[model samples]
Target: MTDYVSTTPGLFPLPDWAKDDLSDLKGHQKHDLISGDEGEEITAAYEQARADVLEVQREADLDRVVEGQLRWDDMLAHPLAVHDAVETRGIVRYYDNNNFYREPVVTGDLEFDGDVAAELETVSELIDDDDDLQAVLPGPYSLFDLATDEHYGDDEEFLAAVGDFLAGELEAFPDHETLFLLEPSLVTDSPAEGLDELASEAIDTVAAATDADVVVQSYWGALEEKVHAHLLDADIDAVGYDFVSNQEDNLYNINEYGTADDISLGLVDGQNTLVEDPEAVRDRTDWVFDQLPVAEFDTVYLTTNTETFYLPYNKFEEKLAVLAEAASLAEVTPA
Candidate 1:
């Protein structure tokens, strides 16, 4: 029998208590207040929110759980944006989404300040088994693309620096089963001539820092041939494709390249309010297998195409159920 595991791309929507806490703190004060007694209160709120989201995932029967990234104000850029080496510039649009993030300007040599590792440490105590938990971090190339580089003049030099910084962060994280290196920028920006090779190298740098299996997940659209080929060559365990956002193109890419590694299919539309029919999702999964060379992978992860923070809390919960049910419908064999 094929074992089925369900997971999310992390960054869940803030719960009511977290929202209330944010409301009380207000504006720039939220960041300022986090260092004092108020910071303790806010920390308590985040912990509660994390616990609540974990309970929801457990109740939904998801095989793995994330810390919900309740404090990631800047989405994928939060970890780097909050670092001392980086400064927040003006607000900028976060890709195609309606949301925004404070642009991170690298003013000095980048260094891992242990913020993400500390956050993971807090969440690690809550989990019964480390194997059932997944940790998430923005991919190095995506971070380099998202930020403004002042310290390193050359693009390749800047990319390598960012990769080293991320590797340090990953090294600090508690042992867990998987690390998801979210790489939406690779898809959004497409592959440039030398960029794909640089990205693969940076990914290898970060992936080597941890014992956990690393999954480099690209969303927002399907990866083009060059980018897909580079990702396959990267030292990562699996590649995730966003089938919901770019179904036909992703299917075509998979058929053309034929993945040799494990695959994660993002079937549920995390950005949309519409809940998908499980039967339709099952059929889609079957079609994906048909396009593969061997019609099998070491593991198949059924997940959301992107972060579910776009959806209303109720809709997000419904989507998780849809993913779990769809995974149950998939045919699997032991690795």
Candidate 2:
């Protein structure tokens, strides 16, 4: 039997109470106006929202629980944008989706500000056991791609700086179970030359800072050969493929190059509105394992292909149910 772990990439949709609290305080657009007593109320609302989301994950019997990132106003770039050296520029479309994030502009030397670390600490206190929580952050390469650099003139220098900053941030986080480095830009904007070595070096710098297991997850599409090889060689524990969006190419790459002993199979379709049947999902997982070489992987993480922010709250919960059901089914089947 395969050890089944279920988790999400962690930008959950804001619950109605959270939205209502923000609106009642001043309006979501004028978030800066929220302060004093109103600010405390808003904070309480976010806490309640986190508790609600965690309860859902716990009730679903998920192995890992995320903080839900309810306060990430600018999506993955929020943590970086909050840094003193970084400033927000014009809004840009986040990948191919309708969602947009304020593009971060690096105005001065990059440094690890405490935004993400502080959030991780707060989340740590909320959970009963540290091992049950998983911390999520945007990958350095993806951060560089999303931001406009003004301090570092050279691209290589800028990339290295971002990696160092991320390393510092990770080092600040309390001992937790896992760290997910989300890297959608790697697939959307594949590097031109020497990508394998460059990406591996950058990823290693950050992964080394944390004692917890590290998983670099790339979504949006399948990874190119050079990129895939680089990630496989990285110091991370596992690499997650966007099986829902690019199943054919991802499967082909897995068959051709093989994968790490630990693999994250994104079986749920987070982007689509349609929910998949649990039995069909089970069959697909079985099919993937059958195609792989013997002893290819020891653990399989059943998860969504992308963040749950794309779905409605109800649909998101429904999808979680599907993942939980599929994971239970996988546990009973022979590997």
Candidate 3:
């Protein structure tokens, strides 16, 4: 029998209470060095949000629970956007969605500042089981595609630098069972000519840094044939496909070139507020398993096609319930 696990890709919506608290504290916000009252309050607000979201994941019986990236206000670029060496430029559309994030312009060599690792540390303290906790971060290729490079004029150099920087950051990450490397750009914007290998190499750099299982999760749409082949060539554990957007193309790619023993299935539609029924989700997952070239998988994750920050908090909570119930339903029958 195959193991089915339900998990989220992180970047959850801020709760209304946290939003209110942050709004009131933004006026009196202070820099990192200064420990002002407002800064303390802001930190408290985020901490509370993390705790609440963790509780939600626990209640839903998700196999892996994330902190929901409550502090990632700038979305995928939050780390680089706040880095000292990188400059936050004007806003850019995030994929084809209505959401937007500040474009990060690399003005110097990338360096690890422990932003994401610190988050893991905080969230790890709240989770009782280390194996149940998962950390999420932006992938190397996506960072290169989304950001502007002014220091390293060469594409290869910048990508390598970003990967090295992330490796350093991962070195400081807290203990966790899994790492979800978000690489939506791999689907939204394919790698440049001759850079696919380099992209996979960069991915290997960061993936090798952690002992946790690494999953290169792509979203928005299915990857191109060549891109899919190169991604499978990476030294990662599993590849997550966006079935909600282009299930047929994703399935075709899997049947053509095949996939890893373990895989992640994005069964929930994150962009839509409508929650899917558990029975339908179970049927779709079974159909996917039947379509696979092989009968058995080591592990199969049921996740959202993309970040659920676009949905209302209530809708997001409902989707989480759906995933947990769907995983239960899928696991009831042997593959």
Highest lDDT among the candidates is held by which one? 3
For 1-335, candidate 1 gives per-residue lDDT tens digits of: 44556789998998766787767755546656433234655667778888889888878878778888888888988877888888888999999878999899999988768888888887789878999889999999889888999889988999999899999998999978988899999999864899789888999999999998788888999888888888788788888999878878877777877664577888888889999987788887787777666666777888998988888888988888887777776643223
lDDT of 2 by residue, 65-178 (tens): 888888887888877777788778798998888999888889898876877887778778877999888999988888878888998997788888988999998888877888
Error of 3 at 92 (Å): 1.7
TM-score of each: 0.94, 0.94, 0.95
Candidate 2, position 245, lDDT: 85
Best by TM-score: 3
- Candidate 3 on 1-335: residue-level lDDT in tens? 68888998999998878888887787556453223233667778888898888888898889999979988767988878778888877889987878898899999878779988988898899878899989898999998888999999999999999999888999999899999999999888889777887888899999999999999999988988888888788788889999999989999999998887789999899879989999999988888878877747788989999988888888988899999999998888645
Candidate 3 deviant stretches above 4 angstroms: 28-38
Tell how far residue 302 is off in model 3, in angstroms: 0.5
Per-candidate clashes, comma-separated = 1, 0, 0
